[model samples]
Target: MITIIKNKTLKTLALCCALGVNFALSGCGAGDSVQAQSNPSTLATKDLSAFVNTFWYVPQAYTLAYSYSSSTNPKTTAVSDQTIWHFTSANGGYLLGCSFTSTNNGASWTSATIVGSVTANNTVSLGFFGGLVTVGSGILTSSSGQPAFLMQMSSGIASTGLTHWAYMLPITSSDPSWSSLPATNNVSVPTATASGC
Candidate 1:
């Protein structure tokens, strides 16, 4: 009886140990699965600088069409005929400034400013300048004399080159707008006088 009882107790202990080991191994497996699911593309700051240095001109210009929602039922309106200027640094970071004319309800406004920055992946954060009237005669200045809209770009930077780029602008707290446009990649090279604008 004693011998049988000892063997049974030993078997129980061994079973518990096996269970513990299995649980530990399973836990590690689960952790690895979670890590895999969290994978995201990331670029270091150094890589961004290298990408920017390759371009001769950091500033470029493009035409953009901007659309926005109205206060009433129509919900949206688009303004085309806008000019945008963009600047990029050596680290693949960029800034854009834009101006345009807008007409609503027979009232016309001639200028709007959008300022923002971007990363190599074309991710953008944008802020809009909301207060200035297009036809105002007074000197317009913010109380703080700062830009009204500010934006930053965070994704799609790697896809940008000398001729084309993907960009984004934050239109509101909940909405971000994106665009693609033509760019002059090589500013150092001389071109025909007709190409000058």
Candidate 2:
């Protein structure tokens, strides 16, 4: 009877240890499943409409590029000047404005505003000089790895149109490069009634 009792006690101990191990392993698996569900595998598409009623700084060194033709300099010149891209929500689409810092003198900025139609892909068709001359199209895309706004614009006549600018703007001020472009002047969004989305 002593031997039988000893054997039964050992079996019970073994069973309890096995159950504890299984529970621990199952708990670990559950934690991993929850973590996987929280992190999405794909990123969502960002559009220009997401930036309505916002102003973004554009650093000339990394963000501004343009081509122009003139009597003295016919080639396109890439300038590093501070600028601000401001947007506003309108009836049909968004009104976009570009305000540039005065290079000739340290004075207030002069803004040129236009109405644009934004697409789901973040493509914008903004008129140049109030639609008198065509400025071409521009696009806004988000960086996959970083929380930044990427802008790409093309300008000039259709026959000689060139990629005007490609710039990166940080979405949050927490980013280290957020202050790279400082806003010195106030930019205002124009009231427009352009027919576009």
Candidate 3:
């Protein structure tokens, strides 16, 4: 379920809604951070707003939330302690509906209609997991092995190569985070004013 807040503005706001979720972890405080195991792009700094134009077709669910800023401020300077994410898939597995939007920068996001039921896995690349002022995941992780969230991007812990259909780990009732899964939109991409790609 996508939990929407009431502080919608522009780029950052929408990103927050899509990528905001304070896992309320115990061992890892808010200050704790994680890095992408491998980055595909040459960019030293990953600009998330770049995804505004470049959307991942069917993401298992966007994990690894982090904050990012470029050229001063992308659009506004509303720092978010939590990061919300947007994941998508063609097959109607988890989020069978179309992608969502937040006119007020995530004050509230509206869900779109579902178009299909053929699920597929998305690409798991470093480009998919880079750039962020901060970082966290819904998946309870350990120092070893890829975060469970990475599975959404590909097959197993070592998923690579081209993109394909794959299922996401089910968020059980025991988990302690506001998590949501797969959804996508190729044509209705949003334009972001933020410049941190």
TM-score of each: 0.28, 0.45, 0.21
Error of 2 at 115 (Å): 0.7
lDDT of 3 by residue, 1-197 (tens): 23233333566344443443432222222333322233345343322222222222213243222223343444223321112233333222232223333223334443433222212232222213322111111222222342233322211122211122222232322433323222322112232211122
Report how far residue 122 has shifted in candidate 3, in Å. 5.3
Candidate 3: Cα lDDT at 66: 26
Q: Write the per-residue lDDT of candidate 1 for residues 1-197, one digit (tens) a residue.
A: 01111123556545434555323222322112111121146553123342221211111222233334434344433323222322234323433334332222112333334444444434444433534422111111122343122222111123221111212121212321112212322211222111221
Q: How far is candidate 2 from the true structure (C-alpha RMSD, Å)?
A: 17.8
Question: Which rank order by TM-score, best down to worst?
Answer: 2, 1, 3
Candidate 2 per-residue C-alpha lDDT over 33-117 given as tens digits, one digit per residue, 9 for 90 to 100: 1111222443333345555655555544554455455533556665434445555554445556543332222234434565566
Q: In candidate 2, list every pair of residues with a backbone clash.
A: 67-76
What's model 3's overall lDDT?
A: 0.27
Clashes found in each candidate (C-alpha, N, C closer than 3 A): 26, 1, 34
Query: lDDT for every model?
Result: 0.28, 0.43, 0.27
Better model by TM-score: candidate 1 vs candidate 2: 2
Off by over 4 Å in 2: 1-50, 64-69, 73-76, 96-108, 130-136, 144-163, 168-197
Residue 162 lDDT in candidate 2: 37
